[model samples]
Target: MKKHIVNLWAFIHLVAHRFATDGVAQTAASLTYTTLLAIVPLITISLTIFSAFPAFQTVSTNLKIFLLENMLPESAGKVISVYMFQFSENAGKLTAIGTVILAITAFLLMQTIEHALNGIWHVRRARPWTQRLLIYWAVLTLGPVLIGGSLYVTSYFTSLTLGLGHEVHGATLYGLKFTPILLTVTAMSLLYLMVPNRYVMARHAWLGGLVAGVCFELMKTLFSNYVSHLPSYTMVYGAFAILPLFLLWIYLSWMVLLLGAVITAMLPQYAQGAMAGEQRVGYQFDLAVRTLVQLSHAHLRGEVLSLVQLVKLTHIHGEMLEQVLISLQDGHWVLRTNQGWALARHPDKILLRELFERLVFDAHHAQLDLGVIVRQPDLNLSDWVRSSAQLKLGEPCR
Candidate 1:
């Protein structure tokens, strides 16, 4: 019981640390701004696509009604709906260049979203621009079509269910009512799974998505109720209440989306540390050296070491391991390949002093080069590290 309590606290601390370090507020604010800029163009493009299909001619109208009834609060929805439809109609009159610009604006929003998600996963690199453009373009083009199709299918089945009420029970009708919640969960799960550059376990993504979906639904209900009951917004903004209300909702939605991502990113740590009571690994020069040595040996043996393999062998936190690996790559002491990490040079040629200098001393150059003189206590820490590594690894110090 005590162990479980300690582990739970540790998990909580880890999450709090990540949230602060990741700058969730700043990221959410950026996304909200970008989303606002992109929303009109996105809606215009989606409406154009919908109009291309005879079957989806009514989709834009239905989607507006759905958003007003389920997503937006009070009079805000009606206000925004009028402007959105108006802009979408005007979008159809745009020239080719204007249409291209609209698509680019929407693409920028998706790019920002991907960048934020990748940052959460500690991914320093991104997919090639061409690949990214293709992917984002497909999503922008196909996503609305899929959504419209789903809504149409749901509405049809709902009508069918109501018509057959005399033959069947009300269970199907009740289930159909929850379609919005189900779709929200499914979309959130896919976002969690697909946005990050790294692999996200399905179970972890789904769990986080479910939490986010439920919270979003509850927030919508509570916020809508608050908006309906409160006259503060209407009294202050009067004719322009919708602007603030819409912006507020977009900001809140981004916050919820980021919270879900944070949860998914940290789920592995929570599972390992909380459930297993894993001992925390403190930063040590020896630990970093040991990790590289293992990788070096694996490279010489014609083997590759995955991140999970390194974690198990080193018994270190996954985040810490990633940090060490990133440092190693930055220092040009290691190279990351499609398979795994390998040595940039032969293991024998790699000196303990060089590795230590690259991984530790070089990284601290900014601090060391500060105007203040080094005190006696800080004398030649690199030399000491080199000597220690030589003694521990039983190799030449060089």
Candidate 2:
């Protein structure tokens, strides 16, 4: 029953921590409402410009369909469609004004999009002004141009593939399917090159970005399929179902972004550490020894005690003890002796016992050591250490 309660409490705390860390969800909701307010004017400005270019007729329609189908909420789409019709009627006179308006609109849109994507990717760095300017510029101008180019490529490829649909067998279809894969790889490469604060190893960035992209694509498909399946929340919270859905999705998206960050940060270091480990055996033993010194009250002696006895008394492993003694010897804390181990400098025998006792007392489990330390939180291993050094120098140990 106690274990059950502890588990329940831990789960509650974990949930609280997650909500506390969720900057992305909070920022996304803020941007979503702001973008909603700007949606109609933004759509009208785009429609006006596209109407002037006959070559972009199909591109514009496809863009409109894509945005309406994928990006906007149902209510927001209706508003955009209404504004688009009105803009279509006045396209001739609106051209020059629309161009200026479009620039302003694109700036707003890119700012929001960049903020949203950065939030999604959990990018925490203060982006330099030069880089930020370049990113905004690319997203504002090159973004639409890229979308146009991608549509053109996809259309051409579809035409080619459809013509030879029957002639393309399993292997041929698989080979031709490289178009989307190539496009994905190219986009992933660009994101790695552009989005990071510092330089990322190309191989690590490629894999991490590909994973993010794949996860994003899967989420998009899953969201589209199940978005309407959110039951009438009357049974759960009635009219408030959308609130939970939105909040939950935002949380899920943030988790995905954090996962990408972890993958990118840890993978390369992990590979390097593994290779380094092969060349350095017994590193753990050395680390354990260092930790022992850090944990102890006074330097160990070589003549009075060997590492074997230290390990036996402390319940630390033999290898770990050897490492600790070797480190101490290297530091000139102890000297070789005919008798097992002894301090390099002769200290008062009684003083050595007291310091050794204190060290042993500290190395116990925390719960057991708490009683002695609680009354003297200011006192540390250093007090005993300095006392032992003083005894060696013939100073009184009071």
Top-lDDT structure, candidate number: 1
How do the residues 275-354 of candidate 1 rate in per-residue lDDT, one tens digit apiece? 34333332445657878878877987988887767877776645557778887777677888876777888778777765
How high is the CA lDDT of each candidate model? 0.75, 0.51
Q: Please, what is the TM-score per model?
A: 0.76, 0.46
Give, for candidate 2, the lowest lDDT window spanning 10 residues. 348-357
Superposed by TM-score, candidate 1 places the C-alpha of residue 346 at a distance from the truth, in angstroms, of 3.6
Prediction 2 TM-score vs. true: 0.46
lDDT of 2 by residue, 293-350 (tens): 4324234422265444554454443333444556556655555454445555443332
Clashes of each: 0, 7
Candidate 1 ranges with C-alpha deviation above 4 Å? 1-9, 52-57, 165-170, 274-321, 330-333, 337-340, 347-398
Cα displacement (angstroms), candidate 1, residue 313, comes to 11
Q: Would you give me the overall lDDT of model 1?
A: 0.75
